[model samples]
Structure formats: structure tokens, C-alpha cells
Target: MNDKFELPPRRRLPDEIRQRMRTRVWEGLGEPDQRPRWTVTVRGRAPIAVAAAVVVLVAGGVTLLQSVQGGGGQPTAGGQATTTRPSQQLGPLLVPGVAQSAVDKCQAVAFAQTTPGDYAEPDRWRPRFSVSLPGREVAVFDAAGPVFCELTRTTVTVSPAVAAPQVLDVSAPASAARVTSLFQTANHTLAGTVDSQVTGLELGLANADGSNGVLGRAALMDGVFVANLPLSERGAAQGGRLLLSATTPTGTLTGSGPVPDGRVWQGTTVDVWPSGDSDPTSRRNQLDRCLDRALVNGLPGTDAEGWQPGARVGSAADQEGVLVAHRDDGQLVACALADQHGAELQLATRIFAPDRTANPDVPVTAVDLSWRFLTVWGAVGPRVARVELVGENTTATGEVVDGTFAVQLAGVTDAAGWETRNVLRAFDAAGNLLYEGTPVIRR
Candidate 1:
């Protein structure tokens, strides 16, 4: 009856499957005699049901371990290798924060790409300068006389020390130069001169350190060219002069004098006009508005000082005038005749305001004087502007729009009782646009 009644579902399993299942269940029990003492702990009973559950759990744990540490140990589509380094495997070198490191980087770049003859020799023409660093120096070499020296910095008790020591030029002729100058700031030397047989000149900066910078050769322009360079050490204008002789085709230039009044003219006589009340005294501020030069009084070989007061006055002579025009927006526009100067001339005046039309050609509007600086705006080349406003936050920049300038003047509030002298500007209806002159108040 037992054999014919048909075995239960468990008894009907294949023989190999049934044997394997039985082996798993037996392994889960405490194997007291096994080499490793492998065993499974059940909370309550040691039944076959619990033993089967333990076998399945152990198999799952073994599969997970194989997946992580076997051939599949490499990163998958959604996973990354845990052994990768973060920094060296990614990007640039780790930069140091030391000041010397920063300085070294700057020096490397400068030395690699710097143009030759940027630094001057010992005798370049430049202004005085003060040095405040260590390891600074200046080098000088004399082509003609026996001259070679180096200026070096040292530490003194109270203040820093800088000393000059003479040396010999061991390499070749002192680079044979017709002219040389010492730039004051860098103390470096500049060698070379204009190719002129008639004129020989040399200039030097009084104070320069070796390590500052180098100077370059002079730049010459044809004709009796003149340059009014502002002295870097002092706020003074130095007059650079060049004399052209009939025998010489060109000549060297030198800053020989200072100009108290700002007049550098090509021609002998100039026409000038002053703005505002057009006072004759203002027009003749410096001996008929003449800056000190070869044409001024008491110059060599010229008796311009001996000439009578009215000797050089001619009605047809050029008229240099300073013009002050008014605008509807309470601004003043000042323009100076570049080459004209005289006392008995009429100051040119124009009302520079916006034209009342659909296509308006706006003029520069200047603010009235009220003992304070005001915003003056003018157009530069139809679009850009020159601006002057007084405030800590005032800033001016240029803009181009539709072939006309868009001048933006900001941080200007109230201006009263301030007289702005030599104020040149242009503007549109929106606001003031450009300014060029140095604004000054009259005493």
C-alpha cells in the first residue's frame, strides 16, 4: 500500500537533488569532528527547516564575496575602483604660497620673454628714484673713459644701504655709443644716441639701483622736434630740445630746461585767447604766454628781451585764445588755441548745447563754477568721451553707439563757487560726455 499510494512530493525528487539538499542540511548542524569546526546556530530548535534556511543564507554570502573579490572585482558600469588616487592622477602641480616662489615665477616669465635693451646702462636720462628692496643693483660701463661699476644694496643700522663699487669692463669696447643716459628709477643704463655728427649729448638718472630695470635707446622724430615730458620724480615739465643745423641732417635731443607755463610751439609767434571775462592779464600770464625756451627773453644769441613791448604785435599775427562756452545744463566748455597767444585778442565763445531736432547733434554742456569741481562731459571722435567728475566713487568709461559717443558720468552731486580753468568737454542731451583739459580754480 505504501509503494502504490504514490510517494509525497519530497519523496518524488531526483536522487542527486535530494542528496545535495540533505548534505547542505547536515553541514548547517554542529560538525563536531570537522577540521574547522563549521557549525550553524538556530535560535530555538535544530530542526531540518531551520537547517535548510541556514544553508541558503550561507550560499548567498559566498556568492557575494566571489563577486567582489574574483574576476568581477574590476569597476562595473555604475561602480568605480576604490584604489584610485585623488590628486596626482587628476591635474596641475601643487603651488607653494611663499613670497619667494611667487617672485621666482614672475622673474622667470619676465626674463624669458623680455625684449633686449629694456634696461638702461649707468648713464640714461631719467628722474630720481628711491630703492627699498634687497639684492637690487645698477650697472654702468664707460666706452671712452675707464668706467665700470655696480650699485648694490646692503643692510644698514637705521636705514637700508646701497653702495656703488667700481669695476673694469673686461669684455670688448664699451659697446661704442654716441649717447647715453642713466634712468633714475631703475639705475640701469641706456646707451645710444641719435645719428647726428653735429650734436653729442648724455643724460643720467641721479639715483638708480642695478636690479631695478633697463632703459632703451632714444626715439627721434624728424624736424626740430620737441617733447614736454613730465618728470616722474617731480611734477615738473622738462623741455626736450633738438637743434638741426644746415650741415647735419638730424640731431640728438636733450631735456635742458623746465617750462613754467605750458607753451610748446613750432612757429615763432602764436595767437591765444582766454575764456570767461577774457582778461588781458590772464592771456599774458608768462611774458606774453611764452614758456621758457630758445624763443623766450634773455635766451642765447636772441635779443627778444631787448625788443620793445609792442615790437612783435601785429594785427594779422596768430591769435591763441582760451574759449569758454556755456551750455543749458549749467556746464562750462574750455578750449585753448594750441599755437596762438596774445593779450588783445577776443576769446572765442560758443553755446554748445543739444540741437532742437529729431536727429539732434548734441554739443558739450559744461557746469558753472561754484568753488567746486563739476561733471564735464564731451564727445571724442563722435562716440567716446572725456569725463571729469569729483567724488570717491566717480568712474568714466567709453562706449560706441550708432557712430556717436555715449559718455557715462557718474558720482557727481553739487558744484558751486568752483571755477574750473582749462576745462574742455563735449556732451549730449542725456549728460556730459568728454573732457580733456586740466581743471583748475582761479585764485
Candidate 2:
């Protein structure tokens, strides 16, 4: 995601509004159209302005519409709607009047909820993202800087407080993003972005039978998407991780992501495979020999000779083992070992990676013992809640064990070019991407 892009705001316009405002946006032609003209141009395509004021909504990187022309007119594709005011560069995002009214009230609520020192000045709060429905079923939602407010014909609502930004992590967001102020919503609508290739969003909510079902969904729209969910507790007290599909492509891509509320649902971490050595004597003998060979190969840490067994990774055959030892700099030196003749062991291959037991980032390392076998392992930190290994021919999720994980893969015959063919990834509980790249290698 680009730093120039902001996070999705709160509230989803009703279905009737969605039906009236569907725009076709061609890929790679999408760019902000903000010029003073009698019309609006989106992605280099022009859309004519209506004779009357039409409601417009903009969030994420796209603009939404309530009406292309005046009330009852069909939606015009490829352009953002605006009030037909001459000499204006563009109309206010969403309906200016409704947005302002909601913002004013929301600001007061936020001010009351926020601690005195944390509150923003009134002028700093601006209506940057918004969406609305026109008529008696009005659902105008505006995210004015730190405050997220929603207005309907009968009631007005906002987030719980002026707090940190939170959203369902269907896709990676910009690093250290600032617009993460309002994620809480008093209404049932959840708003966020999905993978561009994703045509729809399906939420797996908990059922009474301890299973999950698609209780909510959002359709891809020209501007941004909004998910209408069944009304539940604002901060629903629940258990277990909800099924997450941050981005399942239009009949292709599928995956999990972060949830807006950390309480309701998050990534569930499975314990790593334990040191299941059916034969400790044989495993220790091999590990000791591997550590000695590691010393000869310039493995880090002054206590190489005293390095103890940290993990025993089983392989396809008894000839393979992994030697994991701590480096002096809090990193790890994992060496793949093989017995040449059973009297002693030889270091086949090695890797250097973070042993982030105390650090927040997920650690991953990969090494090929034999040209046909590869060993991958890492330590899971507090922030990491999920791990996946992907190759052109390989796909597997990592399980945790005492905060560490190790897995062995057979039939990789391309040691030198393995990284180019495989990818290892780790993610946070909300499906926010943590790491996505090749593991550190020490061949």
C-alpha cells in the first residue's frame, strides 16, 4: 500500500444505495481526479456533472456515489459526482451538509471520550473519507480525521473513542500509517480495503454449533467497500479465532487477515512441533557432532563447544538432523547435519537468522542439507500469530512449540536456487503482514 493512501473509514451505505451507485473502474487507469471542471475524470475517463447536486463518497483510493445525476438518475461510470457549482475544483467528499452535521456531533463525543491531552484541535479534524445514502434511509458515514461518525434518519453514532487505528487486515497497510484513528463503530457496518484482485469479502462468524458461516460480506465497488454485518456487541466478548479471508481473489485468491477488534477475532497460533526425539541418545550424538562441525565452519558465539541441544528436527531419513545454536548477537546458527558413516557427523549446510524470542518480528531461516532436502525453522515472537511456507510446489503452515518452530521438507533438489522458487511468510493475529521474503541462508 502507498503512504499516500489512507485506511478505509467506518460505516457502509445501505444495499439500496449500493445498487444505485455501481461504477466500472478499469485496472491500472485509477488515479485521483481533482480538477476544476464541469465534470469529474476518474482514471483518465471523464464523467459529466448532473444538473442537480449529487452525493459523492470517497474512501481508501476510490470515490463512491449515491447518484450520478440528480435523485432517481442512473449512476454514471468512471467519474466522481459533485455539486454543480462552477469554479470549484471538486465537491466536498460525501454530502457536505450531512458530513458536517455528523462531524460536529462526533467531535463532541470524541472530545468527551478522549483524555484532555490526547484530543485534537477542532481545526485539525477534517472530513477526509466518507460515504452516504440519500432519502429516508439515509446512512451518511464520515471519518473526520480522528473521529468516525455515522448518521441515519433516526439515530447518530460514532466510534468508542479517539484511539489507535484498527481494521480487518485483509491487505497490508502502509508502514507506520497515521490515519488509524477511528476503527470502532457503533453501527454494524465494517469498512476496509481488500486485495485488488478480490471481487468479494466473506466473513466467517461463529455459529452455535462451534462452526463458522458467511454471516457477512461486501462487494467490490469502484471507490471502497463496506461490509454489512449482523448487529453484535460493539466489543463483542467471544472466543476462538474467526475465519478470516482478507483477500480471496475473484474465484482465485483466498486468505485470512486482521480483525478490527482484537477481542472478537484474531489469528490463532498453533504450538510448534515439540522436540519429539523418539531416541534421545542418537539425536544428541548427531547434534553434538553437528555443533563441532559448526565451530569449524565459523559458526558464531564463543560457547560453540558448550552449545547444547535446542531442537531436534526429524527428517525423511536418519541421515539428516538440524543443529540449532545461539549466536552471540541473539541470532541463531542452524546447521543441517548428516552422518557420513555413523561414527561422526558432517555439517551439510547452514543458515543464520533472528532468534527473536524477545523481539517482536517473526524469525525464519532455511537451509538445504542435501540437494534434495531443505530445513526451515524460526522463533515466533509475541506479535507473530501465523506462519506459512510457500513454494512453486510447496505450501505449509507452521506450528509453534515453546515459541519456536521447525519444519523439514524433502524433494527440493535445487539448493542454490531454492529461494527463487519458494517464499516464507509470517503474519500478526489480525492477518497484518509481518514478513514476506526468502528466509536467511548460510550456504
Q: Which candidate leads in lDDT? A: 2
Candidate 2, TM-score vs. the true structure?
0.28
Please write out the lDDT profile of model 2 over residues 185-241, one tens digit for every residue: 323444444434454445444322223333334433332344443324212333222
For candidate 1, report its TM-score: 0.18
Query: Which residue runs of candidate 2 sit more than 4 Å off their true CA positions?
Result: 1-286, 292-308, 316-319, 327-331, 339-366, 378-380, 397-404, 415-417, 427-433, 440-443
List residue ranges in candidate 1 displaced over 4 A. 1-353, 358-364, 367-371, 375-443
Q: TM-score for all predictions?
A: 0.18, 0.28
- What's every prediction's RMSD, in angstroms? 38.6, 27.2
Expressed as tens digits, the lDDT of each residue in 40-99 for candidate 1 is 211111211111111222222211111112121122345432221111221111121223
The superposed Cα distance between candidate 1 and the true structure at residue 179, in angstroms, equals 6.8
Give the 10-residue window scoring lowest on summed lDDT in candidate 1: 154-163
Per-residue error (Å), model 2, residue 386: 5.5
Q: Over the full model, what C-alpha lDDT does candidate 2 score relative to the true structure?
A: 0.41
